[model samples]
Target: MDDEVRELNLTIDLCLRIGEVLLSSGAGAADVTATMQSVAHHLGLRRPDTDVTFTGLSMSYQRSPEEPPIVLLRQVKQRDIDYDILTRVDHLVRDVLAGRLDLFLARSQMATIVSVPRSRRRWAITLGWGVMCAAVAFFLGGNVVVAGTAFLAAAAIDRLQLLMSRRRLPTFYLQVAGGFVATLFAVGVASTDLPADPSLVVTANIIMLLAGIGFMGAIQDALTGFYVTSGARIIEAMMATAGIIAGVSGGLSVGALFGVSVGRFDPGRMLDVEGLAIVVVGSAVAAAAFAFSSYAPRRSLAPIALIASGATAIHALVIAQDIGRTWAAGLAAFFVGLVAYAVAGRVRVPPLVVAVSAIVPLLPGLSIYRGLSLLADGGSGTSMGLLAMITAASVAIALASGVILGEYVAQPLKKEARRLEDRLAGPRLVGPLRAKGRPR
Candidate 1:
């Protein structure tokens, strides 16, 4: 009984974590709502028969087996506010009413989080994938160093581009602005006669970095069984991905006007070990860049970054050896699942946040770009695009599934703890000690 209550509480915490991750990841309200619904469903919080509909920013829930049920409107920027508060109230009420005061005090306790301003301990706390990419590029291959450096510089340019974009600028205008800056930066490097291969690598990586911008939200929506919401998420993801293609295509075309032709990519070059490793590092870097782009709490990046670096190394190793991306993805997803679960359990944090953060490196942003560009240019391998699509889907699915799996692993232990508490709490007291009304 006590364990069940704690799990409910865990669900609430997970909800807020989902919101923060989404917000920091640049997710829209639809993403946030879908994530909250998924968290709620996983915890079994909603009534089995309830009809719950989520708008991107708010929600309408109707609890009923009724022919007609009343709508309960909740319009909050964050989704899980009431759920968390009520979980606390639920535990307290249940304990007092059921004569189970001892339940909460047992081993496996819950704690509240205080969101205080902390120092920016970037390395100590913010171990994200970007730095991992830097290390891989720095150590494994000289060409990669340039690619990593250019990508970082391009990301900086993209951030500045957002300032011009904030006034509700035309989508093309904003994208072109960002892409142009990135392209120009690479062009300047090209003026020094930088090698075509590394320059192309960096340019291509930048282009792919922008794919699946709202994957977490979209996948969360789908998992929560909100097909409509998930479809919207998919469309949004597609639009962003298309924008990436346009930005890259436009920038490449414009750069060639100044004699900086974005070099033609050669698929044969990617078969080498260094190439494969850099790809994995690039994956981790994408995740880091996403969080950095979103202005997440500066302190919480190190461990995540470290995890990314390690995950990428494994991913790269497998792929370079002609092993499938799926095996590597599963390996990466398992560590991610464990970290997300353990951290959430220990610190009252949310698994969704960690899941989103960790999986950024694994998204198939590059594959999507290469696939689409190939199609546009009348190249073969139509299946490459499909592979990229599946790669992105599989990674998200792996992440969500892994986290859910970890939670299932956690439930029974919590349940046992709760049962022990209930046993210790003894039976309920009868009125007047049962024998003689109040005279006993």
Candidate 2:
């Protein structure tokens, strides 16, 4: 009995540790809970009750009705976007479930994954962000000069945010600072005789800042019935977005005082064939660059790029038919969801990495910025600003819901049918849908 209790304790601890990594790295609550359950069951603790929240995770197990339940809790203190760590831990979970790794080996591997310092150079990540924003410029039909300016602006934002992060600043303030720097840079460029559009530079950097917000995970959690976690995520995303608005508003105020206008953006402009091709290439480059900045595995980069390109093409083509932008975004996100699972399997990374990175190029940064700009202008523009903000929110919801729906359709039909039979089951983005030895 004593030995059994000790083993149970260790098993639950391991499960909680795994859950912590998954949750902190932006996995949905459903995925985190399912992965934890799988780990505990495979390690001989069947029927362990796992609870996942935005801030923490806990698991409990009882050997018999009369015995007191043993429980363990792990707090997720930091939320970092490290796809490499997520991919490594995901493979570890698969190996353990497949019986290729025993409890001891699995635990040891998790330890090393959590303890080892990342070898990726900070400067390289900064450079990747720069390139990503540059690609966003091209996607928005900006010229080479605009792309170069966006590159410099993004590099500056990244370095500033990095320094602020080291000082333990909150993420909201970091976003504000990033927005301010991006806008100020664009204003400076507008003041010069440069032929490039400063608006595109600001818009591109806005996209870069918005890319990190977990709209997809938030919607996934909500759809999966983890309302508490979903609400928390939504609040965080909104706060970060608000910070961007405040910072950009401040920069615009400064620009106005200096008689420099950042100009308005027309998102409704239709693209020709050559322009469409540039958008596709830009989307691919942006996705790959974002993956690299987030420390995604190199093996997964090409797959992510291809998926993003295809999705962008779909979105562009759909929008050309006079369909709403929200619908276009949803269609694109659906493609991402449909293809990401198979691509992730081939690349051996979590589908979340591919899905999130692929959707970076589709984030509604332009709408958000345009909304804020109009609101800043006030008067009749206030209504238009509110409308733009509404459109941005709608696009975000569509993107998240569309991706999850695609995952639902793409999951193996047999397993999905069984899961659907259960009233509580949700789509899996980061774990095996069924436990080992469970009937298919």
What local lDDT does model 2 show for residue 78?
A: 71
Candidate 1 wrong stretches, greater than 4 Å = 1-152, 169-180, 187-192, 196-212, 256-259, 264-300, 372-440
User: Largest TM-score belongs to which candidate?
Assistant: 2
Encode model 2's per-residue lDDT on 1-440: one tens digit a residue: 58888888889998998888888888898888878877787888777788888998899998899988998888888756898888889999999998999888999999999888764898999999999999999889898999999999999999999899899999999999989999998899999998988888889999999999989889998998999999999999999998888888888889999999998788865255558888899999999999999999999999999999999999888888888889999999999999898788789898899999999999998998899889888999999999999999999999999998888888755443455422244667887766432222
For all candidates, what are the clash counts? 13, 0
Residues forming the 10-long window of minimal summed lDDT in candidate 2: 414-423
lDDT, candidate 1, 327-402, per-residue tens: 6666666666555545533433244444556666565544544554454444456666566557755755665454
The lDDT of model 1 is 0.45
Q: Whole-model lDDT, candidate 2? A: 0.88
Off by over 4 Å in 2: 413-425, 436-440
TM-score of each: 0.59, 0.96
